[model samples]
Target: MKCRDGQMIPKEQRCDGIVNCADGFDETVAACAELRCQSEQFQCEYGGCVDGQAQCNGTIECIDGSDEKVELCGRRILVRPTTEPPTTAVPRCELPKQPLNGSYSVVSETNTTQTDYVLSYTCDPGFKLVGHSTVLCIEGTWPDKMPRCVQTCQLMKHPSIVYECTEEETEKPRQCNVEEIDGTIVKTSCRKPNYYSPVELPYMHCQQGMWSSGPVCTAECGTLPPESTPLVLRGSTAKFGEVPWHVGIYLKNPKSKKHMQICGGSLISNTIVLSAAHCFWNENTQRLEDVTNYAVAVGKLYRKWYHPDDEPFAQKSDISEIVVPKLYRGVELYYKNDIAIVIASRPFEYKLYVVPVCLDFNEEFSNIQLHNGNRGKAAGFGLTTGMRGSESPVLRVINLPYENYESCLNLTSPALSRYITYDDKICAGSLDGEALCRGDSGGGLAFPSSISGQRRFYLRGIASTSPPTNDQTVCNTHALTSFTSVIKFEKFIKAYWYP
Candidate 1:
């Protein structure tokens, strides 16, 4: 015989109580009904055949159980006429028990001297089913298991918050439940201690299988004093907490075992400082300086390490690592891509004087009209006067007008103008002896930006280099200083800072 798919099989294999074709075409009802039974066998009503002696023997041999019907087997039994009336036998199935918080209904029923039923189950609101919804009943028994209804809460998904949970009696922390049961409580907190949430409490509750809202962690960056006015070496001295994000980069003298302020940086995160790559490069060695030789001081008011006024709020951390772009080539390329990230050995404790400044992640600061005389603030403990003057012991800030690339190029020295590209550098400061001088390298150029209905300082650039004076002075205070633009290296900064 040939199957529907053209596969060959033995003639007797068709309708032999087995499937010979992948689609079951050989055993289908229409095909099986055309089969003939041997003289010594009894044919079933639905098709197929059995031994003659196997029929009407008190057991079913046919697929439909027609071989054991009373109509066909009655002749084989001896009848005793003692009953007052003849009654037809009927088969019944036990009803399944109802699940808690759920119900079941008879979706269908059929009778042919016996009853068969189909049951469907459903859960109440805020509840979920755990198993198959329908079950079949056959001969006083259920063939399928009953389903269960359970109430639970889904796990919260947030970038800044983390959730921890434990069962009522367990001390071990468990994986947050995807479907936390009713009455479960979860504790939430920001991923970093320096971050905050609008929610007063750090707990969430699961009720009726649904979870309450969770807290969202937000970085408390760029906070400033309410009464302080926007105001700086030739610049005015800064008050305490005036520039909270500014940090002093120091190097320990190997011989004296004393730390000395070298460059300046800005705190972009609790453990990360943004600065100029040149600060960490050794020009003579033609390689990066030792990380162990560096340290960062936050909340610093005085350049002198022993200043009594600086100790109370000052926080210090050893440098664990220094990161600079691979394209940065000491001073050969004219300090192109001169950005660096300083990672602290330990996170600085955030305080009123140790907060962080915001980074222009959205390029909002870059789009501003710099040609309209918009100015930015630059702060450092750099030289207070001319190149020959002593470094300022106290921090000071100077407001410098931002200049467009074209104007900056015109003012730049002819020897250095070729290296001042618009994408990698920003031009700021004034030519009236108010520019960033020696020791101001790596300090931030901050521009005021409105964020969340508050005026906050966003770091726009890092002080890189200024043209040298025509005389013997190392720094020309009258030149427009070039700063490495923060917006240009946004991708590089985030890779290390966020990771």
Candidate 2:
């Protein structure tokens, strides 16, 4: 049927709380004034009726052409008998989500019609709102896409301070994954370490994209924790993470394909190590060892064989550079100016298990100078009599008595005597069958640190030579072992490390 304006209308649209004709003519005592319709009959304009097959069957049976109104004539149409909620399939689907920087609410799709939903978003603290204010709920979806409550942070008020999101510059293939609920965090800190802040708080909490609090600027130097001494062990298994300053030097011969423990060293800095020059430079041959396959293993208490389960991660570094004295010359079975500094291939991150030891860079070894009986500890992974030339599984240290300065020079090897001077070498002797042996060369001879109010482990000397074995399968006892005096070469250490 046609309305007064000659507009076509579907026969089923009559009296559907809608007017098919102008001036309320369709629903006013005409059209669909009746509450019901026959099964095969559909009411048309002005109470006219047509067969169901004539409705939207691609043909117009009504005089008003109401049967074929394009929509019903083409697409499958479901006629509603009442206003009761329409039947829909399983509605296991959830609402569309918004960004993490804002909060959202579901005003519709609450176990009701899958159609029509109103989604609204609110920006979090320290953030600004953007995008659409409200989302339209149409067919269980927002016809107008949900607005994003963009995360934003105010510029750092302090001009010298700068920050970047933690997730932004992190290196890939991280060792440990830390899940953060607040998402990517950008931390603001001082631009540089030398700029000098009272507190070195380069780290701060980041919520959303905004700084939760003002960026902190603290100096890194002044905030280091006060030094403390670890418990001294008496020839027992070194506890994991203990004696962290001790190091193992391994050398692999590329030509022979033989890898072996050549010497021991001490960690003095993140990338610097103080060890005997003999580990690399041979004084007798006046030639340097092939260092291409040399590496230092730190953070390991057990030597030679490390238990994978006990210490899963062992930090190893290749020797990138080495410094030896210009005047140094090789002595038969030993060398002079025996000290050297080693630079690591990669930067080291010092932790509890891998820490640098204190050094005698300022002639600070007063305890050794005070008495001839000062018992210094000499530790290494060298061979013991029980092992019969094999490297010790655990680090072995002996309480070696400091020999008198004058007596040390006279009693040491006749060959080293010409090279040894008053202040260049440190001498200590062991009474028992315990002494730093072949693999112990370049190891640190640790003494009680003498920094007032602090008792940190300090390297007294670096091992150079040991007496040959006598009456025992290992190094002989009651013989003086000479070491490269750390104090004698303090100028070299300070020049390179502190400078």
Candidate 3:
């Protein structure tokens, strides 16, 4: 072959199956590229040309001749077999394929009974577990959605109070276990003297399953009583309101007959009497006297029915000690600290009719409010709307309503308009004086007849004062009459005066 430059013609200078140009410019240099055939100009010394294409196709004709310069090769490219190794088959021992962005694995392999494989699963961050941790993987796809491990429950320290099972040790702390259903376990127990309402007794439950959120442990603050238990009064039930007030003379009475005397009082306890404190005091000296003159004439439905008709009206004995807090100084006909405990001369023969009312020491009126709100009943033998000295011949029970404190403060001007502040006092009456009679003072306000019901009056506020000298009806005015909330003095009363 001659050079492209056509300068030399010697046969020895020709490309003779060897590369002589720096760039392998000879076309016959690839002549031994294993073309399997020996043409006179080009032939292979080993394997055949890849794809049956001639190794040198008007370009460099050897395996290494692929390095030829483009000027000599003229855009010609010689083909060759690729040298990459083949891929190996996948092994069966490896874990099943996971999704692109999550983690999953075959928890249990398929068996003859089930063609399904149980898959264990976990999720990326910020996700919560919603479904089962193990799911069936059938025919290369999961049978159900995979579960995720995530943060859900309100992270909590130990609970403030916890409930224990009937046989469980009291000393041990309560724990919240995982629920069978999908939800977080929260809440624990009830504190003493405060039992859960029966409906609320099964204290522990899942938030999402039962409640919309966390389990709120409802703790009680007062005496824990049985379900539907009423403070049963044991004596005769009087007429609608038939207890009479008898004004009689007692031995050792004031010789001058000028002494203020309260002939009848309610038996709050065997030892205590619910009477007007101002009735026994001297207006000038402000001194209380003659504790023994007091007597509780219970069951006196009518004044003249003392013997056969009324069964002698069960005469209870006289008092032992007259204990009235000295702080109770007469402020006005409107008595303050009007409450006095007459240590009963003897333990009361606890008859159903002579039951002691439960007292409200904390002033907390309700644990849960009823939808219609709480309407209470008040019974007394005092005056009516207009009659001054005309007291009811029989005790009368009237329905009364309680008013909010802040709203009552807005009426009759701020200085004169007052809200009930005595810890032992509670207030009742609508903005309009639509309820309560003149003789309702010094009576007990009962509460929460049942756990399921609104807090009924057992012993709440003591009737303290009437509203300021304003004509506005108790219902229409912004302020109304208030009673003393007894809860403030619960400890004081229970400690010193409770028999």
Candidate 4:
């Protein structure tokens, strides 16, 4: 080896506790400390090596006291043999396997006699971790189970749509793909009352660890009947598509077991119809009639309940439920809150002649001035003329001008006028003799309004009652007919409207 002074010396003279170089560089502690020991030797902390058998022998062998240090001898027992190298027993751990659809990296590692490892886990873009993100390996084994990557679903964002997860307890929106478990059911609905999902009863379902997308909400409603011409004349026959929302309510007679058109109703939704509560009242039993005994026929032009020609275009549904306001007291309140919603056994399919009419939501047309000169239309298969007149064989519509609250009160009979109130009733009829009669008790009185740049008919009133005349006529055409205001009972209607 060469000394610091550029003098050459025999390698055996280096670190031999000798001052061979004149400058003493060969015996310097810093220079000798850089030299490493062979596998069979024990190294001193500051300078030189010694025989392996002298290590941890309960005595200080190396001059720097390194061979007998507590840290080195505490966890290891170095077996000494002159013929063989020293041996040590150590604990070691191997690398753990990566999870599926995920990856891991070593955060820290040790290669000494006692080995240890730490790993951090990460999932792919569309996956989520199912366990701890970090893990420790000790004594040749992982301390915790390996994390797994699971498939997750993302929820849709829309202004009119609301989403709810069955598994979540909090109301806050979930972070993307977090806590979205497989087989979870997410319910979807419209945020607004008038808005609805294009898909009925829309929902999202998770399958195979993935979430399916749900339906979007829309406010497209009250579409006019296709190919139907609007008529301005009063007391005229309704076209096939003109009164598509009109429905004939039928009741089965106990003795005859035959269905007959007893009242009229209007389709407000695919599964709901707006009618008068009295339509379902059984006078003999003094209670509401059985739902199974009632049926509704939609998109019918014929007045007859069993018309052969109307079968192809009209759809019939069995009655499931009939809901009336709890505040209603039948005739004691003088037909106050007479409105009722009839739920169909199943949803009706929208067709050219079978569509729902818009309900008077938010009192959009509550102002009487809007209908001052513009007449509202009412359609029914009731009597065409006097009280005793035979029921019309075809559907008919009558256009009538609306009367103010005070004027309607004056025109009503004194016996019934006391019970009439502005909040519960509306007056509409023509003195020239066009009016709804006996069978029109539950029919809808709809007025056309422009909504979203389109003309749509909205139901404003439900045909309720008319005062009896002096001649004992059941339906007097000259009398102003009283209808239950739809807007006044909006809460009750909406409560039962959806599902």
Candidate 5:
């Protein structure tokens, strides 16, 4: 070979990854490359080519420093041939292969008649695969490692899992087993409330030569729900399941835990009650009340309904937990987020009077223009005579129109107007004087959700504060009642409420 500087050398030095000339022309790719690079050979910088196996294998086989450059090396996994003898006593260290059984078969991957083609491998019906499935043929010799089919554990009698160390405990263990190889997955489930799972789905995985710790099912308070329509109440009277998502909150009378004081809640899911945060606030103490001292009644219109009705009457669930968001400074005269989740110890049985109601998430029915003079309906246990907090035992439905925005904006209290947000507070009109009463707090303001053909009543807002000025004789029909719109804080409700 002749160098660019007019020096000459033997032809063998051309592709040897060495600089033999002043200008390094003797090791140039064009002069070094014997022919078009093959699968077993690697193309280097400046058109140079060398044995691909030598590329990034610690030794620089390319004259241009391209062999082991960091860009091409990645994590530098030096996958030595599985057939190499182990360098240590560590079980995973590899060793050369022994003579294979003649019965095992292999075929040329490229052509049936070609002896220099790749070898493909597979095992019989019941065998574990190890190493690459294909090995390459180079210069009449296989340079890559050959794959093997090892026997798996055939544990007819075993526990929920087995590891390499306890393989002997299995009734039908693997034969000639390697020291510590990951085992196959075992199928089973943990009984009762306890659950076994790896990826949500239950499956005992024997990973890294042994059974790994998997996810366990623990008791949680709530789970959210999906799309559906519960029964809607008729003009005024609530039938069984009609307005099923509606719930009546009752605190154990301070004097007696057996007696209950009525409040209101909306059932968003199986075991969750969406209610007003003020329901748990003890005004006397100026603090939140203990959660364990409350109960929720579903599927009933009358707080103390005793007679049989055509629909499912009442299913009472003990309040196990209550979560009120921290956004509100405390229970204020103006109900802000005033929202809370009441977790029931037992799921309310879905019946005529008990069902779930879909929240006005995303304001999906915004096109309905509920705020633009649209009249919304509310089915609550109060206000036939327009009393402040007094509620009749029977549920009553009343249509309240959308009030002028200027009304909530013109409230005498600056704090009320300042805290009343466009999305959060909705001013419903009682132009002829049919506004909500104090007992209606937490009751839902539902409008017809005509999105899908179904007549689903989607809760738009929760009865927060109706300005308590209306009592029997002083009923102001033209007053606008303020409510916390459900669409505004549905996300915050879901995040803090749902388990």
Candidate 6:
């Protein structure tokens, strides 16, 4: 049936093709008309769709318009084509972020492509950026973003002083301060004491009015403890105190009963003993082998002749060689080069009662001459009292002054005066009275220092001689002694140490 608009809605029937009217009448006549439809239509029977056969059933040609005139069916109409446009996708972007405080840079990314961006950080005037200055964008987001630059810290105050003040120019990589002292202005280089390749600005201020000076400058290695002390073999048993004495022996003619005098000696090494060169320099009768006649004793606080205990401190060894400088003039006790070396035939094995002292080479000689000079200890079995006295049983310990060389030379022969020089020799005791006496020649003088956390002593000088005095006066007064300075002979000792 046709609607009020005259548009026919086809009836729900099994038709081979689309029909123009509701009844199957449009399809039956269209099949008989034998008209072919286009590719747009659905193929069906009884729809004027002749298809490939192009044969009409036994009916009038209504689809060909022949049915419109003959069968009186409505004419076929064409459907119109509608026109509309395609839709487009929307565009989007991710938000950018800021770095944290003290930060200089931040990063951002686009969501669609995930592209990264990095930015640098900057601070305002009077402020500083102290943290990481840059960051990278990752996963559509920036890591370490929103950085804030902060203010710089105030510089540390300089020490107060009236002297010209220097400015600190450079700062350490990890540190931010400079050193200042009050006093006179001391101009110091930018070099840091303990750091290598230290950075600098230019100048630093000394707070005080005066500049610092002297040997006070420290080494690059920093402050070190005191020098090693000379080791004493029997140091443990002996009471701790000062003993300034020396050992000596008598020289007698083997053929004639006549007696001659020479300086005695002391042991300071395993195979070395110290003495004066003048004692053996020109003396034709004396030989290095004569060392067997001498001995060393410790423990006796005072001089005593013929003490029974002297043997305990006494150790005797043969002298292998006598080393004296070739320039040495035998006539005078060459005060400066007055020292000699005695090589023992065998090394002295230390026992609990005997010890050796360390020698100080770099020590200050002037210091040893001042307050600490008379403050030394001496050990030997020299005569306790009187000429021609017997040996003491206990080691004779005495306290002696380290005297000036000028005064010591006055006591000796006039010819010997010029031989003594401060560089090689040191003087001790009274020229006209008792001093390092007759039997104390060739002994070691020691100075001690606390080094390596232990009590130690250093062999400082060697006993050389009894200052030359009139034979009658020498007997009337106690003998004054002199020694060769070990500090001066440091090179000489180390040279022949092995040989």
| Candidate number with greatest lDDT | 1
**Could you tell me every candidate's TM-score relative to the true structure?**
0.60, 0.54, 0.42, 0.58, 0.49, 0.41
Model 3, span 1-499: residue lDDT tens = 3432344444443334343333322322221222343343333332222222333454434333332335544775553423332275312232456643357766544231112354667765433445665554332444335465543333332222453321122334334433222243344544433223334534443343343333333323222223323221211223511222111112234464332222334444445655445545556888776776554445444322133555634444555665555677755433556665556567654332333444444323443321123544445545444235544554544445555555445433565443345343455555444434444455444444654553423555555556533554322222344555555545546654442
Instruction: Specify the highest-TM-score model's number.
Output: 1
Give the Cα error of residue 391 in candidate 1, in Å.
Answer: 0.1
* Positional deviation of residue 253's Cα in model 1 after best superposition, in angstroms: 1.7
- Model 2 clash number: 14
Report the candidate with higher lDDT, 1 versus 6.
1
Clashes of each: 2, 14, 44, 0, 8, 65
Please give, for residues 236-332, the per-residue lDDT of candidate 5 as tens digits: 5654445667787876765644645456778876688887777788767766788777888777767563436523467877888888767654445
Model 5 bad stretches (over 4 Å): 1-235, 254-258, 305-311, 330-333, 367-369, 388-390, 410-419, 470-478, 496-499
The local lDDT score (0 to 100) that residue 200 gets in candidate 2 is 57
TM-score of 3: 0.42
Q: Across residues 1-499, which tens digit of lDDT does each residue of candidate 2 receive?
A: 5653367777666554444555333442323335465777765443446676767665544433455555556764553322444386434445676666687776443222222344567877655555665554433334344566555544444434565555444633222112222334545556552123556554444466545566544322111123423434334455555556777888876787655677888887667888888788755568777667688887766675345743664687788888888777656434678887887888565554665666645543445443687776667777665335666777776666677668777766574465555667778765555456778888887666444444455678788876664554556544577888887786788866731
358 Cα displacement, candidate 1 (Å): 0.5
lDDT of each: 0.77, 0.60, 0.42, 0.73, 0.57, 0.44
Q: What is the full ranking by lDDT, best candidate first? A: 1, 4, 2, 5, 6, 3
User: What are the per-residue Cα lDDT tens digits for candidate 1 across 182-251?
Assistant: 6667778876544666666557878776677667677667777665666733588888788889999998
Residue 217 in model 4: lDDT: 63
Clashing residue pairs in candidate 4, if any?
none
Q: What is every candidate's alpha-carbon RMSD to the true fold? A: 18.6, 14.5, 30.1, 19.2, 24.0, 30.7
lDDT of 6 at 448: 47
